[model samples]
Target: MDAIRIQTSAITRPSINLHTNPSGISFMKDKLLETDKSVFSVFGPNLGHYADDIIIVFKCEISPHPDANFSIQAATSFVSGNAFVLRPWLGKDPGSLDE
Candidate 1:
């Protein structure tokens, strides 16, 4: 598995406005319809307390076979010398686990 990092000063910013409609369900439905074949979710530190940055971990399928294998990948951020670094990883699938 490979790990990547993404850093930004706006970590606390809101990416999506779930209150677009009187009922929050509408926004979610619209988002789901816009989604592509691959689905992903975002995770971060717990409420009240926040981390210095954010990290997103996911896997990419590299084969078209029904039993296609997946490669582990991550997107996160880190603090450098007075600056933040953004790193991403897209590696080749490691093949089936039964191998």
Candidate 2:
């Protein structure tokens, strides 16, 4: 019982006080959505249909996450992986400036 209480307290305290604070919640939500859009832009219009499902799922899963760092990291990885996979067909590398 004592161990369980200690574990629970440890888990809840940081999350409640640090991660899930009300004010930062809104900012995290916006940042996640903005990230989704920014990554979508990199893929461009031709891949819209293909990437739409990815964006929807990413938003639904990560938008409510309380840890801002984890959420953004997940978003970045997801977008980067998808972008890398689709780059060949998109006809341009992600780093290139050419139109």
Q: Write the per-residue lDDT of candidate 1 for residues 12-88, one digit (tens) a residue.
A: 23343322323222334333333223333335433423322346554554345576533232211111111122222
Segments of candidate 1 deviating more than 4 angstroms:
1-33, 36-38, 46-99
Please report the TM-score between candidate 2 and the true structure: 0.28
**Candidate-wise lDDT, in order:** 0.31, 0.44
For residue 51, model 2's alpha carbon misses the true position, in angstroms, by 23
lDDT of 2 by residue, 1-99 (tens): 999999999888866864454332233443654542333323223432423233223466665677523321334433345544544554444553221
lDDT, residue 80, candidate 2: 46
User: TM-scores across all candidates?
Assistant: 0.16, 0.28
Measured on C-alpha atoms, candidate 1 has an lDDT of: 0.31
Q: Where does candidate 2 stray beyond 4 Å?
A: 17-82, 85-87, 94-99
Show pairs that collide, candidate 1.
4-76, 5-76, 5-77, 6-76, 6-77
In angstroms, the error of model 2 at 24 is 10
